[model samples]
Target: MLKKLLIANRGEIAVRVIRTAKALGYRTVAVYSEADANAMHTEIADEAVCIGPAQVAASYLNADVILEAARKTGADCIHPGYGFLSENADFSNACKEAGIVFVGPPASAIELMGSKRRSKIAMQKAGVPVVPGYEGDNASDDELIAAAAGIGYPLMIKASAGGGGRGMRLVEKESDLAENIKRARSESKQAFGDDELILERAVIEPRHVEIQIFADRHGNAVYLGERDCSIQRRHQKVVEEAPSPFVTPELRAAMGDAAVKAALACNYEGAGTVEFLVDKDRNFYFLEMNTRLQVEHPVTELITGQDLVSWQMTVAEGLPLPLAQNEIELNGHAIEVRLYAEDPSNGFTPQTGPLHIFKPAEGEGLRFDTGVRSGDEVTPHYDPMLAKVIAWGENRDEARRRLIRALEDTTVFGVTTNRYFLSRIIADSKFGAGEATTAFLQQEFSEDPSLQPAKLNIRQLALAAGVLAHGTVGEQAWSNAPATITPMKLDTGESTVELLVHNKDNVLSCRLGDQHHEIVLASIEKDTLCIIDNGIRQRCQYHRDGDSLYLQAFGESWSVTDLTHQPAAGANGAGSGRIQASMDGAIIDVLAEPGQTVRQGDTLVILEAMKMEHPVKADCDGVVSEILTKKGDQVKRKQLLVEITTN
Candidate 1:
């Protein structure tokens, strides 16, 4: 049943494993990474290769260039579609020493659940309810602060070979546990060269849930129940669902029989998952085990009509276990979300460029697993997750009202996403009463920035002031035409705005303060502009440059300029350059060196990017005259890294 396969991994889970490996008739292949040469899963695979130079250690964690692009695309099975080299147990023992077929699991079960301290000591010797922490192997920082005061003070030090939330931390005092255990062992030795750690007990208001175990090659496993994922932020996940508006049905049959006894205590096969955490009294624990395939597995494939990449290619062809555990019937509520170019009012950051209007969100229980379209290019090299947006219904309040109408009928445009912060956390009310957690976006919308929504819309500022006061020469630019007024300048605080135009029968009547409306233009060419009203069309995007216009929408972006050509204000809100590097990272530590004097919010340089870190401070009183990128170089976006001299 496995005629071809190969994926290895790129965006949107390699276009969701080439649509179920072409609906199970297999033949896929893909691979990519010359910054995804023309991406979209390298133009819908069926065979494609390139494998290197876009740095994921020379392309998606190399592994001998993905086993020579699956032995030069003859494939026969590879599919590691979760993060690079998906759960690499030496890339599944180098695709079983090159005889290929590593659809997932078994590199001795990804080296016993890819080591989070040996999957919490094999889910506490498979009785399954683990998480009281301290996976001993003592690394002495006062013996991990007396094992985080014997696993108590809001603990969690994690990183015994961490995953996405990289090398964790959370202390909460014992005098900040020896500088957060030396910054989680220097970010777990710079992200998993394993600086070894483990302390646990941080659960307050947690939720994560998981379970999706599948196995085969004879040891048959089953469970595909839970999924919640508590809409997290720093600890990663951004919305995910599937049967969990706070799990039940007897806690989904006891976390699906403790996630199939933690995947038969690692004799696991094909797709994996397990995870857990729970807590608001429904109790649950064991939080590790994700050997592969999950970036919210399409909300467990829209509540289990199942297609987990065609059940990981029918359990890697060794097939068996084709649904049992009460024939797994979970048919309703789904959800998903995770669009992410990032920038939920800043601190979510990431955001790169070109996706100029990429639509998404279609009907019948919407899906969209996407890998970027409409002119692609969202580079900073990877994982800015350009698409997931699931939905499905029949329950959980119709899957949170169809995922807030599929995040307001999504419509990305050049970067900056979070699609209105996932439609304000699915029109939150403690996430519509199921009361989410992972600190639910820092406990109900971090200090309220008007609880999120409003990414501008007064019908998109009256269709960008009726396309700059009707300049499409519609009804002959309003007959007598003398009415070509402009005055725009309103960057969210609205200081100016006067636009007024008139184009009769061909309709375009505008006016911006006394309200008049009736735009309906729907397409203007050269930098595009689509308008419409009442039937709601709004698609304004323009770049122009010489007279400055910018505009963009739904992925928020703005700029207007043309203040009658001029520059006047400058009372120290400074912006001419120097103090650069706002992304494209790697510097990780400088803290002012050159002449070093520093003051006003000092920190000076840290950088890192994408896999997180960030610092770079000193914006007022300073001296350090020029550090200009050092600790590990790489630099780029706005590229300066340090210069300071406020003399």
Candidate 2:
């Protein structure tokens, strides 16, 4: 039996495993990078060790270093949480050689199921229906192009050794195949260290359903319902729910049996997920098998009433199945959304900064799993996902509504986030109707008005003016004097507005561009502001840092800047001939140099951050005047990379 557990990952997953391991009477050790010195996981573990630098290759993915940390901490077992080296077969073998139990399946199973090409071939032999595609060993661009001819257009190119949308692309025409293949290969090599590509026929409008299966050392396996992860952006899951609304009782059993067969094919043990694409007619085909716990496991846990981490421990100790397949039961419905530090309006580009205020709403049936707290810095060295918000109810609509409310009430300031975007998705008509498929985001909700950042209205402007005026203790000395008119100028990124405020008798009268209003400040405590806006009692949450303020109200969030004291004189706007870095990242490629002629929309530089690539392009036809960055240099957001003299 294991007495000490070491987590071989970071962020929320590491914290999650440490909590469960401590409750089971085992001492837990946490391994972190130098960048994560003050991270939440390190603070909660019984013992903490710094493995290496912030780059994953130097830390989390460094199997040798992680093993050494476990040995130094006297940990007898290691839990490879999903991501970094979770599906690495060599890491599993190394733990066995070191005489430490790895809380996952055997090395042989991981090796077989880790490759999408190999797994699809294995599933075909195991009598499981597989997607029609090419899974050959030859991954050359020429070979893949030839295979695309046979598979036809509108097929998918996937990285053989990767998942989670990395190294994946949808090819719609013959003309677009080669470029997409090149991009797919490049992304695959960067993300998984494998440039192998596979071709598959795209399943149109299919529901992304996956079965959760668990096995023990003994010959027993059972499936725990299913999770519908059809709602996605860029093939990354945005929302996931348990007991899919599209799955019937009969269909669920069939998919579950197939998942168990796939698990038993490689002599699998521990937690695994088998994903499938189910057509409108209910025909399901194998997609891929995830050989570790999934990010959306909370939904399954809420429905099945089981702690999967505890089961992993029991199975690692060579136990039998906890319950028979027939005895397993699922109840209620649960939905979850991934809260990320990103700007949805700007193509969901990742954002990084200090988290001045991070608070999850508290309520029954609500579960928040997070890794950071107030004042934590969101760096570009790791994934931008901040937390997971899950809600459970007796039915689907109830769960959806509860999730919507939770996302709206949750507060995250300092950096831009997708809190409001997530609320809009959950409240969308198609999502509320339980009719969303994989094409929901692209085909149906592509033009959603809520995708843009909220515009500052007069009401919110009045409230901001009132908040700015309320805290002035010295200014109140002029109560006996006539009404004092204070001028304020605020910028909301999208636009700017100026207003005049007069404070008298706890009422703030404000004027903006010939419009007048009165806002009564009912009360103010900490960050919460309770006010009566035009006879309507409402509340808003805010965080102030000097002249900058972040506010959340009316189901939207806004960042207001005080520009009253700053003088501005320039016609320079977005197309100012200056290309700036969108976020802090490493410069992978510099496409332009001094004296180079460029056209509008030409790629100037490419930056890699949060495990993805972002290209900075020219905004107008021009000649490059200066290039400030080079390959391999780290840069900050809004830092100038290239300057061009426009025509």
Candidate 3:
């Protein structure tokens, strides 16, 4: 067994590996960046080291620094958890050269499977069915454009070295192919350092199911099970479940066999996942092989009753397969939802801030895998995934219901999240019937009103007013004088609402325009407000940050700003011409130059954040009067990037 193990990653994954490694009697070391100085992973490990700054390139991806930390800590094995350098061939080689065990596949296997182009060819030779298109070495712009003619319209240009939807684009017609290809290459180069791309005939409305395969050094391998990751946004999985509802035993066996064959063909070892796109007719084609433990591994663990991380360690120590194919049994159903610090109402933009209350629901058959707590900071230097909530049950419906209840009770107050959105997806009729496909979010759930952020209703506004005046109301609880009427103003994102509020004997009367509400405050404990709105008792969670308040009610989160005491209005050039950064990010591209004429909605700058690119477009047609920010500049949210004089 490995003596000392170091985790070359951060967040929930690093915390996950550390717990498992320690439980298996291996001394665990954690590596972190400046931004993670006080992260939970660093705090829990037996030993910790600061590798570099907040940026990933200078920290998590700095293999040399990570290796040096391992050497100093006397760690004999390094586990590159899911992201960062987990699948980097060169990093694996470097670990081997340093006489340290890389707890993953061999360098050769990684190199071969890392490239989608090469992997597709290798899979073809191995008799695994693959989506037909182009994976040739001729990757020049013109070559790709020419290949599109042969592949026909409605094809996917995918980054050869990409996963999680980065550097992937769908071209519906010939005219859009060239531009999408350029975008794919640029994004791929920034993400994977290799701009090589592969074209595949788009498999419309297919179910994305991946088989989990584990191999040992002694030429033994077995398939654990399959996971359905069909519901997606921007090509990334939003919800995942084990023992795919859409896959029958026959399809599962075939996919498992193919996944095992693909693993063996590349001489793979340790834990890996072979993904496939299964059409409506049950025809499955090779997608890509993720050469690391997936984020959704908990769902598999719940169904199979196995510790995959421990298995990875066992394989790293040259142990044979834990169990044969016949010994493995898929027992129960498990569902998982990714809890992200993102605004689902606003294009899923990543959110960063202090976590005022990061409490996940606790119950039977519920598991919360998280690395941050109430006081931990969510930074912009990494992915915004805060936690993974997995629920297990005896049947699929039980699991689904448990997941929905857990999601509703989960609280993440300070930062915006998709907590409600995840519940809505699982509760939807289409998803309940397991009919979701890769296009489910765009095709089915796009216009679902429940998926959008909840606007404050009259009851919620009354609750907010009562909560806002809780302290003062409590002080005047026994006062005999008539209740004082106070006028206040609140900005509810949609529009400003002026309200009249006063508390008498713990009952508050609030009037917004012509609407009047009588709310009785019952109790206030640790941010949970219990109030009776017109005789109906309600409990909701809220967090107040200065004048800005966030409330969690009605299975959705609402933001309100107390603008009562502030100045009312001012004329501004917000929508007329100024192009502002929508979020805090680094400028990766500047498309507009000063004095250039551009149309409204024309993209002027590209901002990269949280491993995704967002285009800052011109809000109005005009001549570009100034290019305030250039490429490589770090900008804050709402910072002016361009000044356009409207026509």
Candidate 4:
């Protein structure tokens, strides 16, 4: 068995590996960046080291420094948990050269399966069905464009070396070919350091399913099962389930067999996933292979009754396969929803701030995998995934209902999250029926009014704020008289919530829009409030930053404004209109000029953030008076980007 294992990663994954390593009697070493010195992983390890700064290139991806940390810690093995260097071929080779065990696949296997184009060709050669496309070596732009035409319209241009849809684009017509190709190449270069691309005939409304396969050094491998990852947004999975509801035994066997074949072809070892795009007709074609433990691995673990991380460790120590294909049994169904620090109401833009309240749901058959806690800040330097909530049950409907209940009961205040949105997806009739496709979000949930939070009076919030900003019956309580007193107004930017309030005899009554709710401060703790509303007590979690309060209640997180005492504002950009940066990000491209004419909906600027491109369009017809920021400039949220003299 390996003696000491150094984790070359961070967040929940590092913590996850550390727990398993410790339980298996192996000492663990944690590596962190400057920003994560006080992180949970660092705190939990037997030993810790600061690798570099918060920037990924300087820290997590810094292979040499990570190796040095291993050497200094006298670790016998380096476990590149999932991201960062988990699939980096060079890093694996370096670990081998340093006489350190790389707890993953062979460097040669990563090299073979790392690129989508190469992997597809290998699969094709191994008799696995693959989508027809162009993956020729050293192809020019014109060659790729020509190949796209050959592949026909409505094809996908994918980064030859990408996953998670970083460098993928769908071209519906010939007019979009050039621009899509250019953007794809640029994004590919930035994400994977390879500008090469592969073209594929788009599989319409396919069910995204992947088979989990594990191999050992002794030429033994077995496919565990398949996971349905069809629920997606921007081409990344949002919800994943084990023992796919849409897959029958016959289809599962075929997919599993093909996955085993692919593993064998690569001379694979350790844990890997072979993904496929299954059409409505049950015809599955080879998609890219992910050479690491997936984010949704818990669902598989729940259904299979196995600890995959342990298998990886045992295999890394030169052990044979843990079990044969016949020994493995899929016992139950499991579903997992990714909890992200993102605003679903807004284009799923990643949110950053302190998690004033990070409470994961608890019950039978529930597993919460998280990193951050209350008071921890959600930074822009890392992925926005806050946690993974997995629920297991005896059947698909049982699992689905359990997942829905858990998701709707969870609370994560301070940062805007997709928690509410995840619940909506799982509760939908189509999703519960296992009819979710790759286009599920775009087709059924995009801008769905039902997903938006129900609007409430800011005055009730102000009353809660009054208790939070001061305290119940404290030195800061609202003062000076007939306590059933004055009226106040709160502007939420979208609407002004008028309020008539007073606090007397422990009863607080506030009226809003022909409705009234009597509020009594039951209790108050730091970031938590217990309010008695009309003889019923309800507890809520909240964090106040100036006039904005991020609160959580009834499985939803929201940001409310308390403008009880601010000057009334004119319409946004009332006079000299300027299109401001919607969020803090880097300017990738500028389509408007200082003197350019623009219409109400023409793209004026493009910003790249959280690994996605957001086009900023003109809100009104105007002549651009000034362009404050240029391409490649880093911008702050709400900063003036393009000044326009509206007609």
* Top of the candidates by TM-score: 2
Per-model TM-score on C-alpha atoms: 0.33, 0.91, 0.89, 0.85
Candidate 2 runs further than 4 Å off: 139-153, 173-183, 472-481, 514-517, 567-583, 587-608, 612-647
Worst 10 residues of 4 by lDDT: 471-480
Whose lDDT is greatest here? Answer: 2
> What tens-digit string does per-residue lDDT give for candidate 2 at 1-31?
7899999999999998999999999999999
User: Candidate 4 residues 1-647, lDDT tens each?
Assistant: 67999999999889888999999999999999997898888999999999999789999999999999999999999999988999999999999999999999999999989888888889999999999889988577899888887889789999988888889999899899899989999999997799988899999999999999999989998999999999887888889999998999999999999999999999999999999999999999999788889888888999999999999999999999889999999998999998998877666788765677787778888888877787787766789888899999999888888888788777777667888788888888888877889988888877675356446554445455445334333342334345655465554433555676666655666666577667776666666667776567887767666666666666665565665555544234323356877666789999988888888878999987676688887877889998888999977666789878888
Candidate 4 ranges with C-alpha deviation above 4 Å: 145-150, 450-470, 473-483, 489-496, 502-507, 513-515, 518-538, 543-548, 561-647
Q: Show model 1 residue runs off by greater than 4 Å.
A: 1-115, 118-161, 165-186, 189-194, 197-258, 263-328, 332-335, 339-390, 393-405, 408-415, 420-481, 485-647
**How well does candidate 4 match the true structure in TM-score terms?**
0.85
- Candidate 3 global CA lDDT score: 0.88
The residue pairs that clash in candidate 1, if any, are: 522-531
- How should the candidates be ordered by TM-score, best one leading? 2, 3, 4, 1
Using TM-score as the yardstick, the better of models 1 and 4 is 4
lDDT of 1 by residue, 1-647 (tens): 56988887887788878987888677888888787888888888877899878878887888897788788777877888887778878778778888888888888788777778877887888888887868877477887787677677878787887876877878787888888888888988887677888788888777888888888879878888888888787888888888788777998898888888888877888788888888889889888888887888888877878788788778888878678778888888888888888776667778665666677767778888888888776767677878888888888888788777777766665566777777777887888888778887886688655334334445555555555554542333333344444445443322334445455443666566666667666556665577666787767656443443556555445544344324433111233214776656678688668877877666778877676687867666767777767787877655666666575
Model 2 lDDT on a 0 to 1 scale: 0.89
Cα deviation of 483 in candidate 2 (Å)?
1.8
| lDDT string, candidate 3, 1-647, tens digits | 57999999999999999999989999999999998999999999999999999998899999999999999999999999998999999999999999999999999999998889999999999999999899889489898888889988789999998887889998999999889999999999997789999899999899999999999888898999899999888778899999899999999999999999999999999999999999999999999999999999999999999999999999999989889999999998999999998988877889866788888888999999999999887777899899999999999899999999899888887778888889999899999998999889998899876556656777778877877776443343324367899887787755678889878987888887788888787777657788876578889888887777778876777777787777643212334576777667889999989889999889999998887789888877899999999899988766888988888
